[model samples]
Target: MSPALTAEIAQRFAAIALGHVRREYPNKPGHVLAGPEDARTPRELHPIFYGSFDWHSCVHGYWMLAHLLQRFPQIEAAPAIRALFDAQLTPDNVEGECAYLAAPEARGFERPYGWGWLLKLSAELSLHTHHAWFDTLQPLADALVARFEDFLPIATYPVRVGTHFNTAFALRLAADYAEATGNGALFSLLCETALRWYGTDENCPAWGEPSGDDFLSSALVEAECMRRLMPQDDFLGWFDRFLPQIEAGQPETLFSPARVSDRSDGKIAHLDGLNLSRAWCWRALGKAIPEDDPRRSMMVAAAEAHLAAALPHVAGDYMGEHWLASFATLALEA
Candidate 1:
């Protein structure tokens, strides 16, 4: 994306995260108003995560900060990032976040989407084994893990949309966490579920992509998730079947990035995320394919195309600003 991530970019991303991770105003709690007693401010509802527009955005905002901090600890923003984590990631705050999630009306609150992000944040922290952040966040992470175990068996069909509900998106993010933490049970479950839901999908209809508010590419995300779980040889075979026409660029929808006409419109801003996420998937799928495969070059080209389209818009409007850097990070890292 930038040849490499620099300290300047790290500082910028960190500053964006720090600006909203604690700015408790102009928020949305996603809380159900059951009664007068149930009414509470966002800070009261989610003590550790009351900023960044919504819960999941805030979760990934932290992920972005932690990710940058891990990669560029020499940046000026590193100290502030560490200090924020030290003050906010305490056991009591996490417990409050967990308690809010455990409420009866919160059953479908963040569901698989936010569940995946929380685990991802935990996984990133897991990389910093010497840091206390992982220990401080373990309880909250464990709570989300339990939710995943309880929910996956009942989610009969995979969500194939290109938005937050996309099953592959959640599984893809959570897989990194599972592998990093050596959660064999979770990893196996993810593999099994991926095979069961998407093992036979072929000749994907990529034309119906970039639905007005879509963020993830359903077809590409599924391919990316399968690539992670399957053996290299087996995955190459499966990918060939999944998008057999890629060599000729038949799924033109994927080769060309979506256009975002309005960064300020929240729903329209999703196109920016769609482009970044597609780039991420294309890069992952590209890297995993065999060196001599012609499709590998095509995939890499498409990934760069998509990255070129969206990387510069990561910090424009509040809607895109709140979360696009994480998507950009995912694409760049992939």
Candidate 2:
């Protein structure tokens, strides 16, 4: 079996996220300044998610910590995790985040990537029934939900990149939030938007995969998005058409792990996340296929191969360390 998320692993991931989620310096802001007055610090703009190098990474870093805390409440870092949430995931902080989003100049700030992670974080928080973090964070999540509601209809074309702009990755992450909150309208919109964008895609060559700065598999992530939004049998048919030669691994790039040349260089380090995210998509797709299908085992093997290549490097360098644990958590949990 592929490596599962054990208490030991959860503890380690929680510690890594906690180490930098609140570390303010060495930051990269995605904000668009409209004027000199808008040129504020990351913390000044994003009261809660101004750490872990960038906003989106910091958002998912919080998601990883919240998920780990829920999965292994007895872990050593549980107290710290809870304390962090209690202090930061408050109404006042959430209001500050919403205020940032309300800015006219910040309309496209983080776009679908940060928007998705923020919702994912909200979804995970909702699973913690005993805590009020979800309620505290709901306003910000609602703001992003409105963004998706407004954006999807006019987004005539999908961004199939392997980087943050990928629409498939955003839809996949946001679906969790839609279902968790029982927002039927958002759920239906996500499903319909995914179909409209990717339904007719077939024989995805994946030739442009593993682009220099890519952290996602454009092909597999779209497949995973369809899997999440479609019914199982319908998704099986779609999957067959999408990647017909999965059993043979015709698109070898999807099966193979990306090689990272330099962990210190942030862009190159994204290859590690690419491997981990590929593992995530592979594992989910593997489980979706019937046990009798030959592709199931192949997908599982591919997932294991990718995980092995990337798991050991999740924390060695600060470039990868600040965010890779979240992707590793996604793969392990998937």
Q: How do all models score by TM-score?
A: 0.97, 0.99
In order, candidate lDDTs are: 0.88, 0.93
For candidate 1, list the clashing residue pairs, or say none: none
RMSD of 1: 1.3
Which lDDT value does model 2 have at 201?
91
Q: How would you encode candidate 2's per-residue C-alpha lDDT over 72-185 as one tens digit per residue? A: 999999999999999998888999999999988778888899999999999999899655899889899999999999999999999999899999999999999999989999
Candidate 1 Cα misplacement greater than 4 A, ranges:
none
Show pairs that collide, candidate 2: none
**Residue range 201-287, candidate 1, lDDT tens digits:** 889878788799989998999999999888888898898899999999978898989999999999999999999999999888888
Best by lDDT: 2
Off by over 4 Å in 2: none
